[model samples]
Target: MTKVFIIKFSIFILFSFILSTVSAFAQVDVEKMAKNFNIYLAFPEKHFQLKDGKYSGGTSPQDFANVSIEKIVIKDLNGDGLDDAVLVTVGNYGGSGGFYELTALLSTSSGLVQTNSIVLGDRINIKKIQVHSPEAHSPPELGLIKQNFEILIYMLKHKPNDPACCPTEPTMECFTIHKNKLIPCKEAPEPPVVKKPALYLYPIKNQEVEVEINPKGKVLKTIPEYREKWKVYVTKNGKINGKYNYLFYETTLNAPIPEYQRGWVVSHKELSRWFDVTLTKFGLNKREIRDFKAYWLNELPQFPYYEIRPLDTQFVEENLTIKINPKPATVIRVILHFKGTDTPSKLEEPAIITNVRKGFTAVEWGGILENSPNSDIKPQAKYSFLAQDTGVVVLRAIDLREHKLSIKLSSNGCTDKKALKSIVKKLEGINSQVPHYEITLIREKPDRCKALISEGTTIVYDLKEEFGINTKLPYTVTVKNPIYPLITDEPYFQFFPKKELKPKPVEEDMSLKEHLIKATVRAIEMEIKRYETSQQRDKEDKIDRLRNEIEKFNKMKPEDYILGYPNGAESSMEMFTYGPLMPPIHRQVEAIIEEPLKIGSILKLTTMTKSGPFYHIAGINENIDIAKELKQGRYRMKLYLVYKREYFGFIQNYYVYIAEVEKQ
Candidate 1:
């Protein structure tokens, strides 16, 4: 059994983003509803009116018009991601019984629309009536609940043979809007859990870590490709040794949300000490605590006091199927939540229980700390990365000309090196009614630039040159990555070539050139993993820490196999860079080695912008020095060559980088 410990750390309440979502209740004439309103309920089958919140018609004790908006709160009721209104109204007809109804007013783009009305039992006394939890979170606390709207209604119902005025049997009921009607939420096994729970990973020994979870709902978003189940090596310092030092992946799962009442209540001033003592007890190391604080320190709300509650660890262990491999001996996971209040809430201190960190221990800490109105943190302005999600990469609108193929695709500014040679599988051709070919867009190298292009860039692939596809005929081009077709509708045109195609058909044997390109692309991708790496928290200190980590990593023992080193490059490769040999013609010419070449391979070189060649491959490396022919002021060039190595029986290749030369 995995001895896991989870903590919910609530630092302070701060609103994530200030959204202008005015509630429908604000527009609703609730005062008018309490005054003269029509009540359609079980007891009062006919229309009954309540003028000024009361109607006592002396025609009979049963003829009474008692209509009042008992509880009016604002929340989303129709899953439209907007604030709606829910009201509990009382009606007095048939003297002995009092009719209580649940009414929903859904908010629309134009105005509020009254949707459904439900009746609670007659002659029941409402104990507590509210929309949110004890925390009293506003409608801005969206994304927590998904499909349904919930309201807490606690009341006392009459028992058998009890007095008409007062007969009490207290009961609490939770009601959610279903299919535009309010119903008791008893069918669902558990209440929904909070979204974005960051599960940090800290392993004692340096080992590849992979966590797989089976959430009731889908895993909405998780960084570092959790869906792929990529094995990430985590160092003792809790850093995922990679280009980006991602420690853990947070997920939004559907499970029972754990609630904790027993915790410490403190003001913002007492936070530092609170973190040191409480997190220490929770078995978090100094480094982990620092990371936790750094992420939330600036966003901390400056309320008079706060209620810190850790979500129950049991809820995490059972509901969330978190399977860690090479199973951890000890695990500590904490999610802190802070509720800011006007006054200090006296809370009972819950006993913290966690096992000592043994071999292969794992520690995860994250929380959902919402902000109050008096929060110190102000909402930041939104800049538009504003591009629609690629969902990997969306490919559509394919127009194929004679030699060149124009494709409309999703891009992130640096998509020029998105792919070199693509694998085109002619699954169904000439024989089938709708000719189909599955084209796999292989991104030979990742676009390192962080430019967010609003409109995606276009990809113009030379059918005879790039992917080696012949576009003389028409055939529907289906991108196999997402099974999306190029030119989805009528007039689908794409020709799959026979001899020129680098990736041969799945059924046919691969040509020597196709086999080599496939092997080299894989090799280049593998080498790209170790490029430019750093880890930092979310504050000013994070910069310093990342700098320190990079320096430390660079200075590690040579035997440790330092990060950012070329794959399989044990000392053979040198920084392929040079300047002018003669003095009068002071030229600084440079060439980026696209790939390493074998002994007899051609030494090709081209201008940095790839407009024209500075010194193109005229002869093999063994025959001539390509640099000698360059006549330039200061030229940047690109060298295209193959770095092939025989791995026992299989062939492997690698890319030579520019950064590797800087160190030399």
Candidate 2:
């Protein structure tokens, strides 16, 4: 009996040992699960960059590895505030190639650390999976109920037509829990409460605030108005606009009290209150600190109150001179004068003297030091002294107090190399640099003018007329290296340095062309006027003069003047003319010529004796030609009369008429 009991105990122990060994090797045999799933850490400080295997490149997946990524969200696997990553791996269970495992990585100080592999029990096949709500944080508990965050893992089953794989069949195998631990009862239904996304605000001082949502979160009322120290209302989509009021003050030259105090309005939607500001004051008030005087003030966004920085004031040396020689630039007026100095500290009104050289004038001074208007510096009385010739001005500040500052002043003439150098030196000292406008070129002409020549491109007339740029069409602007880089448009042109050529006097050539044309036109005009005057005199005189001129012109030979040919070639030339005839003669000729000329049956031409011949000429044809006999006073030349060719001695009659040949 003892021997049998001992054997039974040994058998039991052997069976337990076998079970333990199998369990330990079972998980190890399956393909090792992927580890180290992580989301980004604190904002821009600790951010994400794409890793080589599955992500990070250009616009496509195929790009250089190790691209810097901005941000990505991750969800917590359990109820912990920290987030977890989802990953996939395939390998042998115990050997090199057996099973595949899907796992997650959680955030750790050392780096991304692997979390426990979630089991997709009994399925044996998951084509794809996703984890949602990756980055969740714990909230301060305000009640007995602690805030619970959860992550959703979606698994795509590979079995086709299976209820779990077929969406139409609507079947799923889910392994989930209420919080971190497994569900108490697997039969319980998922909660139905809609979890709305909370709004997060990021404000930039003096700029707009931005808002965003993630993880398919919905915001029904993104613009919730909060009225406590300040009020907020929805100004734009998903953003809250707010406005607040605070006291603003400006001190006067008098030490007694500040000049003014009023509520200044401001708007803020930020978590922080401090903001930088600039003030521009315009009013119809006192002269010294009013009307046109503007002070730029910087202050905190929280208050209406502002502290006036030390005034940016510089005095020009009194007697400035600009020579009107060379190319006389349009001088509208001049301003250069001296003024007494005043301390910014104590309160007495700043002195204003006459003829302050203003407008777009530059001033030169050694250095300028101004105490903050709000600071404890005593105000000193200022006096002005003007010396226009030398361009030297002086401003001596005097007070009953012990401190005195005397500054030398010179005109701020950019043309004056020395003064410009000083201005440039002073400019370098300022923090926020502004390029001074020594000159601004503008085009205003036939069109709304354009720059025909700029930095380099050869501008065309049509381009100048239309786009005002040297490009044929409008360009799409793309920002490259923004600051100080040249902006170019398509089709981009390369600029080559061109040798500068001094302009020669084009006025002489232009003047010669203009005057020569003018003279010829004027002479032709004068001849027309003279002819009209002669015709306007007594009818007989006009007729006689016309007749005489016609006779002389027709009787004249085809000289060089008439032919206008230097060699006087007259091989095929024909000449003719006519003039007014006396009444009886004209009446007889009209009776002879009228019916035939009008009917176009025969041609009659009256010509001066000098017209050599009308060879190959014949009477007009009534059917194809048309003419009208002129009354005596309007007699003119015709070239259609018969003529004998002196050299050939050939008589050729042609159907020619004065109307057809000479535009009668």
Candidate 3:
């Protein structure tokens, strides 16, 4: 067996270590604020009671509904420096009818605390929701737009008492908790109507804009933008049966909710209105309609994310701007939250890595490795890498003065333990290999086998060829001593004939026709034997393999053959024969010339193997000339024998032409 060694050693050894540190970078602490604003974990059902008072506490096992967090946005409700969270859930719930909730959870050192339970929509309903709110921002505000965000809230028919129970016109409203009391805004205005404002609604700035070409000129995908905020209010003249109670509220005690004024209905209609205006007004296409069906804490299925009829939409942009808020604390709070179902809590679901550094950037500075000096490496016990839709392995490099290191984190593909260790050791060794040198080796071949040679790069090789009739040859390469191991994941090298193995090399030529005929005869013998011995065999498939192999040999020049064996027999001009083989041929037969040629044409040839005549091209040999020789009738052409068997073998010889054709 012929073996080839691939040397993938990088000489530039980067002296670095996978510094292990505590899990300090995973969270950003927003110090505790005023009293009475204590954070608690709500178990989705049973009113969100005080922490450890009656209902499940925050992040407790019982409260977690097994699910993944898709979206997490933070906003301040009382201007307290501390951020509150809105956790959006995704991934496997208890199948159909199982709720897909996106509750607004209050974030704290205590963990995610559910404030309001909102359902996104189901597979069927989600489509409709998309039509209603293609880019659903939690709360709709005319501001800068970013990602395609949509929100849909479906409420149950109000079941209240004393005239304020049913409304003539059912609309969305916001409920607030004050001094441990549920207060519904009675004076909340019906969903507002603003004729899709004529402000610039497209062309998001500072982001990659892909322009795909159709029959029309270049067109960009439309990306709708909006805000996630609301205005809260309280009114005594609350509408009952969609009409104000004339007797009770004759006076106007109109005032916005004190602390809750900014928190209002992140409505479904507003979402729908926005979708219509942006998608239709601009131009963006919807490829997927994801439905999210959310259930109440009681597991009562309600609110669907996308449930609008015929929700498919598309768009094109004009000009858009990203409203950069100088103070994210004022407009946005980066917090972590997870979405979940009522039954199986999604508390433990790994939070998706969002609005943070990409994995590539993080992997640098030892973030991707299992163990480092700067951090503790914990195996994500519950979720497999495949199940992780998104996750973050944060790393912070703080000098002695605690100044954050500005190094970029690059994601590397070394997930396995062995691979990761190799990388770490290789990098650690760089400092000694080459004190102050950097080298990069680029592969010359098509494959990814580039060599990065630097003073610090460590490499080892054993390029010796083995000799034996039937032997398992092994070619090994080990690179050490550099600060970092060469990151050559793949490499390739040309196989050259060993000098000692061949006493003397002689060049010879062979004819195409003669090669093809001899290969066919050999193939016929192999097929017949296989057919007689095998319990179940097809004669046609075998014949096909035979023919393909012969054609392959005819196309190749003998000199380029990897097999260094001399031609089996030499045939002279006086009498030449390749010898016949005994056979009731069973192999399928067909022939193909690599290059169709005229009389005076030159063609390169090679041979391959397969089970059937319709075999795929595998290997190739040298080149041959079909032109008439200077001495007429003296044909000098190379030929190769082709066979369809367990192993590939070849024979070579030169041929003489009996006749020649004149040039046209």
Candidate 4:
């Protein structure tokens, strides 16, 4: 009986060992299963397809190039005593960007079969995937595993605040298999709100201190500051309630001094010593402190203060000049203002002042009236100065403030009526001239006008016509030429010849020329065969046309030929037609007169002649002479006409000389 029992036990142990080994082998191959799941998804067939059918069944398997399995998790989900598969795949379709999907496949006796699929979202990212662990619950409960361990997929979802390429929100999705179907389970709770730490600066007596505080307003720590004038800076970590992980220190000059001291000046050497001591107290090594001190010395400003003062209150020609006490490393800006307006208005664009030495700087204001008429100076105008790190100061004009003129003007001796009359008569002689008057005041000293004329000066003056001259001028002039009709030949039609029209030679075929000949022979044979097979009477006519076309092509040359048709209707007929011909190209004409004419001088055409098809100053140069003697005249001293094709048969340019006159 003992021997029989031992034999039975031995057989039982052997059977158990074999069964265990087979079970181990039966376990699912994760990589192989993932590939099969990807194919089952049929991504390639959906992405690339023709209207008639999908492009999926070729000899080679479809790669689904842009689609990839990002992650896979295997676990039992339905109490089936078999591991199930969950795959996260990402597909990128060119312009549409990327999309992510979650796929669950159940293990059956045959193979892994897809039970459920869920499209996550466009441009989503799969962060992680795993079996839902019951241990995650507080005071771990048994009911969490009721669904045979639910599948948990962790992904990054794109929120409104997220960028186009990166997702920002963390999301957890739970799924379970019930009744042979994948169903959604309860979602995990959202993460807790994080608290960030910040650094705040507060004034302590005569010094400043930096204190780090948590989001709840609780003090974390105080960053040590060696010098009373030093400032501390901190940067927060990535999380919303994250701690500040970085800190830096900088020396400042805006710190207030002790109340006991009225005024104190600190030298550069003393400041350097203080900086080194402060850095050392902050736990900086010798090398670091030395380097920081060197940097501070190099970056220190040379001058700390600037001063501006009005040089002259009374300005001539609306000019204003100011004196600035120069200081190195300081910038100054000067702006002018017009007074007696609804509000303080700028006289002109602001001027930048830079690169000054220790001496006084002088700034002049002139040409303000011509450049900025909108801000032209009124009876009462003022100027303002602004220095960097300093405030602005406004100063009244000296001349306007005092109600006096710096320069004297006398128009009593300046009169020329005879010259004005001559200019008017000359303008009246020209049909295109428009007569106008312009009076200019000539100053004995160009630099010193009737009023102050400086960099930003604006002068407003009324001209007395009795003491001025009337200048005759034409704003625009048109040159005309007579029209003439001429006949010419124009192209109508042309024929292009073809030397060789043949397909490229294939490696297995003959050369291009020989291939063409063979193709031609084949075409002729086909035509002949068609002609013989057809019962219609027109078949012979078609074959004859094809033969003629071949003959003509064979005899054609390589060059293109052009045929001319002079008449509109008949190609073979040539007829005379009338139309305006292009005008002859002429060189630009210019001349100078030795004497300057008055503002009202008139210019008249003295002669008219014919050249080519037009009559009237044709070949002669047409231009009004501009000379110093004619500077008093506001009108054109010399006129220049540039000939163009559009003026071919309209009008010709005429030249007029101004009569010499004596200056009064």
Each prediction's TM-score against the native?
0.33, 0.15, 0.16, 0.24
Instruction: Give candidate 2's whole-model lDDT.
Output: 0.25
Q: Write the per-residue lDDT of candidate 3 for residues 590-653, one digit (tens) a residue.
A: 2324333322111222121111112211112213233322222222223232332331112121
Expressed as tens digits, the lDDT of each residue in 1-664 for candidate 4 is: 9999999999999999998876655554643554554333322223222222112232211122256667766666555677666777666522224556677777888887776456666577788877754333421322332212466677888665565467888887776554565655532111111111111211112232232211111122332422322233322211111232222221111111111211123343455675565434333345444644454344332323111111122322122111111211221222211112212222322222233422221112111111111212111222112111111111112121121112122112222121111111111223445533322222222221222211122223212233222223232221111112221321211111112122232233223223233333333443344354444457677667657645643553322211111221221111111111111112222222233322211122222111111111211111233353434422322221111111212223211112223232
lDDT of 4: 0.33
- lDDT against true structure, model 1: 0.48
**Which rank order by lDDT, best down to worst?**
1, 4, 2, 3
Between candidates 1 and 4, the one scoring higher on TM-score is 1
Two-way lDDT contest, 1 vs 4, winner: 1
Which runs of model 4 end up more than 4 angstroms from their true locations?
1-16, 37-65, 133-148, 186-664
RMSD to native for every prediction?
Answer: 33.8, 40.1, 35.3, 38.3
The CA lDDT at 549 in model 1 is 43
- The per-residue C-alpha lDDT of model 2 at residue 405 equals 16
Candidate 2: tens digits of C-alpha lDDT, residues 140-203: 2211111223333334443333432122322233222232232212222222111111221222
**lDDT winner, 1 or 2:** 1
The whole-model lDDT of each prediction reads 0.48, 0.25, 0.24, 0.33
**Index of the highest-TM-score prediction:** 1
- lDDT, residue 494, candidate 1: 16
Candidate 2 total steric clashes = 54
